[model samples]
Target: MSIWGRVFAAGYDRIMEGAEKSVLRAHRQALVGRASGRVLEIGGGTGANLPFYGDDVAELVITEPEEPMARRLEDKLAASARTAEVVRAPAEDLPFVDASFDVVVSTLVLCTVGDPAKSLTEIRRLLKPDGRLLFLEHVRSDDPGLARWQDRLHGIQVRIGHGCHCNRDTLASIESAGFTVSELRHDQLLKAPPIVRPLVIGIAQAKA
Candidate 1:
């Protein structure tokens, strides 16, 4: 991993502190708390969702592609005394068998996947027929002018965020990935810049 990866991992929770206190913590508590059965969380950065997971979850597995982030995630899990497992794995090429999970959680993750379509496909593959996907992602702006701004500033955002695209149509991507969106809500990512503020929190399941 590059030096920036370590730096990013080191400062991950600190940088997100403001947003976490003001907005993200509540969102996570609501969404992640609902996860149950065998669960998988993709790109589990710094293990932020660790505290939110409930005892209802039969098993919890987290995957982080970046080495530095993976190490930090493990450390956090250790500190929290959570018995979850952490693996060094990317979203697109997860090293798991088919239908291995009853729920898959993605929080601020889809946009950073090297291939959103492939990653979502992998998530679909890992989930059982009745499984659900829980997602909380910042997506392309619904407003036109702000979207243009996002397009213009996207490259810089990628460099700063280390591969996260600020203008992805993640909601549409979920639908196209063969998941039926069962519940959804649009909200703003408060305490963050407007370019990446549009958020979508929802639950989806595989199409029958």
Candidate 2:
């Protein structure tokens, strides 16, 4: 987990540069651009999605629990020339009131939370009745062979990723948490190892 410390924070952007250029950056643009009104983002790692937020957004707040990541995020926020707030908070324990936000953004973040289901429940609680959750995550593969690989490599990936699980059934978890996945795009995390490549991007809203 020390790797997820200062060293990871210092080199995080550089490490993901290739993946960002290959596929992630575009996906971020498409999903994050849709964010509007009062928005709250979980993790906000390195502020990678910082550049894509559209001007229609009424207010933007990002929470990051890790000190190392939060420091990096704050630094990036200082340089981004954008108007937003950065808070030191975890996904599973956000401080906002219920139904306070119109959008909750989670990009490449759900898999790494301390409690994915609980974190999402908090997201649901924070969102307004019609609010949206914009998410892009790598989940357990549908293929049995690949899923097996994901299972084998999951621990190693978590160690290296600092808490990221390579084999979570994230989409299913979202549905179980009571959100209706309104739009979905199945995709691959290009330029990554097979065990962690399976991906899904989508929008979900709380059920009535």
Candidate 3:
């Protein structure tokens, strides 16, 4: 990982604590009934989903590539009501058997993955044949001007805020990775001028 990524991981949980507690909570709440069985959370930063998981979920396994972020995730898991296993690994190379999980949850992680399609493929592999993949991501805007601005600012943002890119087409990547949309929605998460990102939520099932 880049030094900047490590730095960002160290303080990211603290920096985004409020947003996780506030802005992100409602969106996550909508997913309560969807998560169940053995759940695998890719890029499970600071175990944010631990608190939101449903009681029916038998196990929760989280993968986080960044060591510093993994530490935070461990700490949060310890404090959370949800019981979970934490793994320090990237989404592309998950250390588990195929079809190991019944539900795969990813929130705001695609933008940072070096290859979103590959990561999504890994998610598909981990999911059971009838399993669901639930996601919450920020995608590129449709406005030409905004898209251009995202392209312009992405490089700087990646340098400063870890590997977070502002313009990933997360929906397209998921589709290409062999998942079909079951439920989908798009909305704004922030009200800042120019609106750098639009939040996207979807429930997808394995192709089989």
Candidate 4:
């Protein structure tokens, strides 16, 4: 990880606290509350979603690539009522068998991955035939004017945000990866910057 990556990881929880209280807390609770059977959460930064997982989840595995973030996630997992195995791994290269999980989750992570297509393909590979993928991601805005601004500032955003692209077309990437989107909702975050505020929260199933 780069120095900025380390700095961001160290302050991630503190930075996200306000957004968590305003909207993300509820969004995460609703998204993870429905997950069941074997679960795998990609990019489990600081274990923010750990508290929302339902009791019905048979097993939970969280993957975090950054050492600093993974260590913080471990601390969060240790205190949670729910038990999960925390592994240090990247989203594009998950170390799991095909069709190993019944449900997979991605929240606030698709934007930062080096290759969204590869990561989504991996998510599809890890899911069972009838498995579901629940995601809450910030995506490129549809508004032309705002999109222009996103395009303008994207480079700087990536440099400062630890590889997080502010204008990724995450929903389209999920579709291109062969996951049939079942439900999707678009909205802006309450306390986030406009460039990264446009969000897509939804569920998708791996194509059989």
Work out the TM-score per prediction: 0.98, 0.97, 0.92, 0.98
A best-first ranking of the candidates according to their lDDT comes to 1, 4, 2, 3
Tens digit per residue, CA lDDT, model 3, 1-208: 6676677877776776666665677888787457988988889887767777888889888899888788888988888777888888898889999988999999989888888878888899889999999999888887788888888888887766678888888888888888899999987765332433477898999887
Tell me, by lDDT, which candidate is best. Answer: 1
Question: Is candidate 2 or 3 superior in TM-score?
Answer: 2
In model 1, where do residues sit more than 4 Å from their true spots?
none
Candidate that beats the other on TM-score, 3 or 4, i.e. the better one: 4
Tens-place lDDT per residue, model 1, 45-146, is 888999999989999999998988888888888888578988889999999999999999999999999999999999999999999999999999999999
Better-scoring candidate (TM-score), 1 or 2: 1
Q: What is the lDDT of residue 198 in candidate 2?
A: 84
Q: Is candidate 1 or candidate 4 better by lDDT?
A: 1
Candidate 3 has its poorest 10 consecutive residues by lDDT at: 188-197
Q: What is the lDDT of residue 185 in candidate 2?
A: 97
Cα-based RMSD of candidate 4: 0.8
Task: List, residue by residue over 108-138, the lDDT tens digit for candidate 2.
Answer: 8999998999999999999999999999999
When 1 and 4 are scored with TM-score, the better candidate is 1
Listing every candidate in turn, what is its Cα RMSD in Å to the true structure after a full C-alpha superposition? 0.7, 1.1, 1.9, 0.8
Residue 189 accuracy (lDDT) in model 1:
83
lDDT of model 3, residue 34: 72
Best-to-worst order by TM-score is: 1, 4, 2, 3
